[model samples]
Target: MNTTKLAGNFLLPISLLIFSLTAFSCSADLEDKVVGNWQGYDFLFQKTEGPDIVVTINGGLEQHLRSKLILSDNGTFQKLVGEYDNGKGTWVVEEDKLITTNENGEKLIYTLLKVTDKELMTLHEVDLKTPDGTLKGKIILSYTR
Candidate 1:
């Protein structure tokens, strides 16, 4: 094969690889956009029960605790919920998930629903034991800067 033809064939693949890497790197930048203080405005917990496990929403005035999450540019974070303070620790973003580990080596993960300069929303699922059986629920958190 001629040298020019051989080089042309390699160029397309190289260009595609570069483009793919650029796109992947941009996705990772989403973490940087989330580095700031976020004040929790709404925290809704939906609990399910009975044979069908129907979900019921309990929030608004029922939630008395104030909460906040502060994320530093250095990959460290602190979470404050009411009077309880979850010790600071390291945090990272993997795809659409935010994974955080506390000072006590406890790990918590939240699914990123939406994040912007002004607002952030996340969802977390929890299983709790009830008198009847195991109940599945979700805690949805809405925050603002």
Candidate 2:
């Protein structure tokens, strides 16, 4: 067997293993940063055809109605966005996205803008249907520990 060919074959697997390990480490780092209790304080709703609304929940009764998200190390989460959107389910971080699957098998994907020991910011676009028409907008949920 040619020595160069033998060395090349071994190098490929080793390189791939190193790459996989590095990626897993980075993913675990993100998972660690997000595993905590977070309180939603800023809810920004930007609509495509209407006025954008911003709701800032201060330290009062408003805080009681704001979003609360709990991300666990066991790959589960509970999310309550405002007074309506509430569910408990499993969650995973894929690249820059935080994906959650609720008990009803509904998937909510949030694009993660930032995540730190104290803050997690995410944006999710939604289409709401009403008797008038379909309203398209994006919701930015900002949470703090």
Candidate 3:
């Protein structure tokens, strides 16, 4: 076997391994940016050709119902929607999606649309009951610390 060819073959695998490790470390660091207290900044549930669902921020009932999410580096989370709707869950990031599995084995998947040091926006789709019928719509949630 040619010596150069042998060295080239070994170098490719070593370079790939190093790249994979670096990517994984960077992903962990990105996840760390999500660890902290996050308050609801925007919540829009819009239906096709219709007005958006309202989330009042002026200390009304809907404002009081807004949830605060706390993410921990240990992959655990607490979401307090209201006095009666506190939830605990485990979360993981797969690619750009955030998957949260609650204690009851229900999983909610959110596509991470944006993430910054102070803001995180996620898109979720779900079947919702409308006046006409049931249909799938998007829920855009924005959070800030």
Model number with the top lDDT:
2
RMSD of 1: 15.6
- Using lDDT as the measure, name the better of candidate 2 and candidate 3: 2
Q: Write the per-residue lDDT of candidate 1 for residues 1-145, one digit (tens) a residue.
A: 3432343355446434533443343437769878999888866454433233323223331342377789998999987767577578999988867888998888888867667788776766767665667766555677899
User: All candidates' lDDT scores?
Assistant: 0.66, 0.67, 0.64
Off by over 4 Å in 2: 1-25, 49-65, 81-85
Q: Candidate 3: misplaced stretches above 4 Å? A: 1-26, 48-65, 129-132
| Candidate numbers sorted by TM-score from highest down | 2, 3, 1
Q: Count the backbone clashes (under 3 Å) in each candidate.
A: 0, 0, 0
Which pairs, if any, clash in model 3? none
Show pairs that collide, candidate 1.
none
- For candidate 1, the lDDT comes to 0.66
* TM-score for each candidate, following the candidate numbering: 0.65, 0.68, 0.66
After superposition on all C-alphas, the RMSD of every candidate to the true structure, in Å, is 15.6, 15.7, 15.5
Q: Write the per-residue lDDT of candidate 2 for residues 6-95, one digit (tens) a residue.
A: 433554454345345434435567778889889977654445543222222122225533768999999999877665656899999887
What order do candidates take by lDDT, descending?
Answer: 2, 1, 3
Clashes of 3: 0
TM-score for candidate 3, residues paired by index: 0.66
